[model samples]
Target: MIQLKTREEIELMYESAQLVSKTLGILAKEVRPGVTTLYLDKIAEEYIRDHGAVPGFLGLYDFPNTLCMSPNEQVVHGIPNHKPLKDGDIISIDCGALKNGFYGDQAFTFAVGTIDPEIDKMMRITRQSLYAGIKKCKVGNRIGDISFAIQLICENAGYGVVRELVGHGLGKEMHEDPQVPNYGRKGSGPKIEEGLVIAIEPMVNLGTYKVKFHNDGWTVTTRDNQPSCHFEHDVAVVNGEPKLLSTYKYINEALGITSNEEDEFLYNFMHD
Candidate 1:
C-alpha cells in the first residue's frame, strides 16, 4: 500500500531531511585524503543525536552503521571501516534521519581529494540524472517517466545504471511503496500522484550495470570493478508537482560549490 503524507507530515519529514543534509555538510569538510569513514560515521551519529533526531540507519536492519560509505568501485551499502580514504578516491555517503514520526533519506558521492577526470565526469552525469528523474515526478506521470529520464542520461553517456538496487518511497518507514528503479519502460510502473513522497536515487556505474553482493551482507560493488556514483534526494509530490524535501545546498556550501541545480525543486511551503 502506498502511503501518502499529509502536508504537515511532509513538513515534518522536511525537517528530518534537512538534518541529514546538514549532517552531510558537516562530513564534507572532513572528507580529505587521510580521514577514515568510521570516523565520519561517528561524527554523523553524534550530530544527528545532538539535533534531537534518531540516526535512521543505525540498527534498522541489524545494520551497524550510521552511514553507508561506499568508495571507488563500491556501488552502495558499504560499511564504514578504519581504512583511510586516499586522494583520487570518491565516496558515496548515504544518510537518513527519523524525526517526528517521519523519515528522510539522501545520498551524495564526494571526491576524496583530486580525482580522475573521467571519474569526475561520471559523478557529474550521475548527479545530473538525479534531477532529470526529479523533473518527471509530477501529477500525471508514471514512475517509469522518472526512471526513463535517469536511464537515458546515464546510458547515453556510456555509463551503467545499477539494476538490482532501486530507490523507494519513504515516510514513517525507511522503505515504503512504489519502487523507483533506474531503468524501466517509458510508460510503465505506478502512476505518480500528489502526496507521494519518495527517495529518488540514481546509482550509476562506470562499467557494467551488474553488481556483486559481498559476504558481509552489506557491501555492493560494480561487477567489472569500475567506479560508480550515487546521488539521491527525498522528494514529495506537492500541489501537483515534485518538490524536494532534501537539499544539497548545505553540502555545496560546505564544499564551496555554487550551483543552483536544486532551485527548481524547492518546496513552496518552505519559503513561507
Candidate 2:
C-alpha cells in the first residue's frame, strides 16, 4: 500500500533528508583522487550518528555500509572498499537517514577530479532528467508521467536508462509503495496524489541499459562496462504541487556550484 505522509510527518522526513544532504556535502570535500570510499563511509556513519540520526542503509538488508559507493560503471549498491578513487572516476553515493520515525533518502554521482568530457556530459544529462521527473510529480498525474519524463530526457541524449533498479516511495520505512521506474508509458501506473512522498532517481548509463550483478551479490554494473550516472531527490506532493524535501545545495556548496535548479520545487513551509 502507498503510505501518504501527513504534513507534520513530511516535515520530520525533511529533517532526516537534510542530514543526508549534509552528510553528502561533508564527503564532497573529501572525494578527491587517493581517497578511499571506505574512508568516506566511515565519515558518513560518524557524522549521521553525531547528528542523532541512525544510518538508514547500514544493516537494513544485512548490508554493511553507511553509503552505496558505486564508481565508474557500477550503477548502484556498490560496497565501500579499500581501493582508492582515481582521477577521472565518478562515484555515486546513495545515502539515507532515519530520524523521528521517518526516512530520507538521496543520491548523487560525483567526479573524483578532472573527468572525461563525455562522462561529464552524461552526468549533467542524468541529473537534469531527475528534475524532469520531479516536475511531473504533482496532483492528477500518474506515476508513469514522472517515469516517462525521465526516460525521454535520457533517451533523447542517447543515454541508457537503467530498468532493473527503480526509485521508490519513502516514509517511516525506507522503501514504500508506488515503484518509480525511469522508463514507462506516458499514461500508466498509479495516480499520484497529495501527501505522496517518493524518491525519484534516474540511473542513466552511457551504454546499453542492460546491467549485471557482481559476485559479491551487492554491486551492480553496466553490462557493456560503460560509465553510468545516478541522481536522486526526495519529494512530496502538496497542495496540487510537488515540494522538494531534500536539497543538493549542500553538495553544490561543497563543489562551489550555484544553480537554481531546485527553485521551482521549493515548498513554502520549508525555511531557507
Candidate 3:
C-alpha cells in the first residue's frame, strides 16, 4: 500500500532530510584521493549520532556500514572498506539518516581527482538524468512517467540503465511504499499525489545494462566491469510540483563548483 504523509509528518520528514543534507555536507569535504571509504563511513556515523539522528543504514537488515560506497563499476550497495581511493577513480556514496521518526536518503557519484573524459561525461549526464526524473514527480503523474523520463535521457546517451535495484518512498522507515524504478513506460505504475515523497535515483553504466553481485552478497557491479554513475534526490510533491528535499549544493560548494541545476526545484526555499 502507498503511504501518504500529513502536513505535520511532512515537516518531520523535512527535518530528517536536513540531517541527511548535513551528513552529506561533511562527507563532501572529506572525500579526496587516498581517503578510504571505510574511514568516511565512520565519520558519517559519528556526525549523524552527534546531531541526534541515527545512521539509518548501519545494522539495518544486518548491513554493516553507515554509507553505501560504490566505486567505479560498482552500481550500488558497495560496502566501504580500507581501500584508498586513487586518482581518476569515482565512487558513489549513498547515505540514509533517521531523525524525529523520519528517514532521509540520498546518493552522489564523485570523482576522486581528475578523471577520464568518458567517465566524466557519464557522471555529468547521469546527474542530469536525475533531474529529468525529478521533473516528473508531481501531482497527477504516474511513477512510470518519472522512470521513463530518466530512462529516456540516459539511454539516449548510450549509457546502460541498471534494472535490478530501484529507488523507493521515504518516511518513518528507511524504505516505504512504491518502488521507484529507473526504467519504465510512461503512464504506468502508481499515481503521484501531494505529500508523496520519494528518492529518485538513476544508476547508469558505460557498458551493458546488466550488473552482478559480489560473493560478499552486498556489492553490485556492472556485468561488463565498466564504469558506472549514480545520482539521487529526495523529492516531495507539493502545490502540484516536485519540491526537492535533498540538494547537491553541499557537494558543489565543497568542490568549488557552481551549477544552477536545482534552482528550479528550490526556488521558493532559496528565497525563504
Q: Please count the clashing residue pairs in each candidate, in the order shown.
A: 0, 0, 0
Estimate, for each residue in 136-187, the C-alpha lDDT of model 2 and write its tens digit: 9988899999999999999999999999999999998899998999999888
Tell me how candidate 1 scores on lDDT.
Answer: 0.95
Tens digits of per-residue lDDT for model 3 on 1-272?
Answer: 77888767766777778778778888989888999999999999999999999999999888999999999999999999999999999999999998898898999998888899999999999999899999999888899999999999989999999999999999988888899999999999999998898999899999999999899879999999999989988898877788888888888888888999998888244332
Better candidate number, 1 or 2, judged by lDDT: 1
| Candidate order by decreasing lDDT | 1, 2, 3
| TM-score of each predicted structure versus truth | 0.99, 0.98, 0.97
How many Å off is the CA of 125 in candidate 3?
Answer: 0.6
All candidates: CA RMSD (Å): 0.9, 1.2, 1.6
lDDT of each: 0.95, 0.94, 0.89
Q: Flag the better candidate by TM-score, 1 or 3.
A: 1
User: Model 1: per-residue lDDT, tens digit, 1-272?
Assistant: 89988899989999999999999999999999999999999999999999999999999899899999999999999999999999999999999999898998999999988999999999999999999999999989999999999999999999999999999999999999989999998889998888999999999999999999999999999999999999999999999898999999999999999998998889867552
